[model samples]
Target: MLGRLFLKLEFKKVDYAELYLWLGSLMKNNCKQRRQFLVMAAGLLAASVVPAWAAGVSGEVKALEGVAWRNDQPLKLGDPIMLGDHLRTGADSKLVVRLGGDVYLLRANGSLQLENKGLVLGSLRLLSGALLAVFAKSNKQIITPTVTAGIRGTGLYVEASEQSTYFCLCYGEVELMPMHQRSQQFRFKANHHKAHTLDAKGGVEKSPLRNHNDDELAILEALAGRKPHALVG
Candidate 1:
C-alpha cells in the first residue's frame, strides 16, 4: 500500500509539470500576438500623420530694407505666408522671394502684388523697377502684370521704369500686352527681347532689341542687396 501511494504521488507530479509547460507556451504565444498587433497599429498611425504636415506653403523671403505684407501682417524671413499680400520693395531696396515653387528676384525699388495662394497665380503688378521670374515647369498660369512682362514656364527678365516695361526672354516664351489693353496679346520667343510703349489711344508699339547679360547681373544684385560685380563670379 505504501509503494502504491508513492507511485500515485509521482504520477500526480508528472501531470502537474506537463500542465505548467503547456500553459507557459500558450502565454508566450499570446504575448507575441499582442506585440505584433501593437507594432502594426503604430505603423498605421505614422502613415496617417505624414500627409497632414505637407499641405502648406514652403518658401522664403528676404527683405533688404523694405517691408512685405502677408495676410494684413508684416512678413519676415522664416515666417509662414498666406495669399493676397502685397510685397513692396522700397527705393534702393531689394527683395528675394519664393512663392509656391517659383523664385522671384525683385530689384531695387520694386513691388509685386500677390493675387493667389500658391507659388504662382492671379496677377502680379510691377509698380516700378525690375523683376526676374524663374518659373517651374509644373506651374501653368497666365501671369498678368500691369506695366510689366509675363513669362510662362520659363525664365525671363523684366525691367520697368518711368518710360516703359522691357522684357527679355532668357530661356522660355513671354506674353506681353499693354496694361490698359488686355485684349491684344504678343508672344516673344527665347533668345529674343522686346519693349512695349503705350500711346495716347491705349495702343501698344513693340520694338525689338539685342539681348544682353545685364539681366543676370541685375538678378544677382537684387538677391544680394549689393552690386552684382561684388558678389557674382
Candidate 2:
C-alpha cells in the first residue's frame, strides 16, 4: 500500500519519538493566534466575495490529523471542503482530500487554494509548500510559483517557493511549462521518473529526484481509485 510505502520511505526518521517531537513544534500559539489568522483570511476573502461564493461543495476531508485549517476554521475528519477554499497545514500535519476524482495529499507546513470551476478544475494554486496529487482520467492542471503542469490521470509531487518549484511526474503523463513562457512546453511519460526544477526567471532545468517515492504515488493513486503503472527506471 502507498501509505505503508511512505512509512517505510520515511524510516530515516523511524523513531516515533522524534516524529512526535517534530509535530509538537507545530502547535499554534493558542486560540488567540488562530482567531487572528482567521480574521486576516476573512478580511482578504471579503475583498473577493464573488469568487468565494462561486466555490461550492467539491469534496470531503477523508483524513485529517494534527493542525490543519479550512476556511478559517479547524478541520475535522470528514469535513466537507468547498471550492475556492484556502487550506493550510501546520507542522507535522497531514491531510487527504478527494475532489471530484482527484485525490490530494497536503503535507506539513503546506498551503494551497482549492478549485473546481463548474465541473473542470480551472485553477489550483500551491502557494508555498508541497502536495502529492493523483488524478483520474481527466485533463487537469496544477499551478505553482513558477510553472504549470497539465496532467491526465497521473501521480505527481510538487514543491513551490518564491525561488523555484520542484516537480516529479511519479507516473502517467504530464505537460509542463513555465508560467511566464507558456509557449516553451514539454511532455513527460513515465512512472517514478522525470523530475525537474522550474526557476523564477523562466528557466526550466533538470533536477535530480528528491523527497518522493513510488509508495507515495501508490497511496495517492489508491485514494483516487486507481493505481500507479510501475515502470522500469
Question: Which has the greatest TM-score?
Answer: 2
TM-score of each: 0.53, 0.71
**Decoy 2 TM-score against native:** 0.71
State the lDDT of candidate 2 residue by residue for 111-217, as single tens digits: 98977678557667899888987777877778888998888887788999988999988778988888888788888897567888989877877888887655445
Tens digits of per-residue lDDT, candidate 1, 81-143, equal 445666666565555665654556676656666677354465566656677666655433333
Candidate of highest lDDT: 2
User: Each candidate's lDDT (Cα)?
Assistant: 0.49, 0.68
| Model 1 stretches with alpha carbons more than 4 Å out | 1-55, 62-74, 117-120, 138-150, 161-163, 192-233
Clash pairs (backbone) in predicted model 2:
170-192
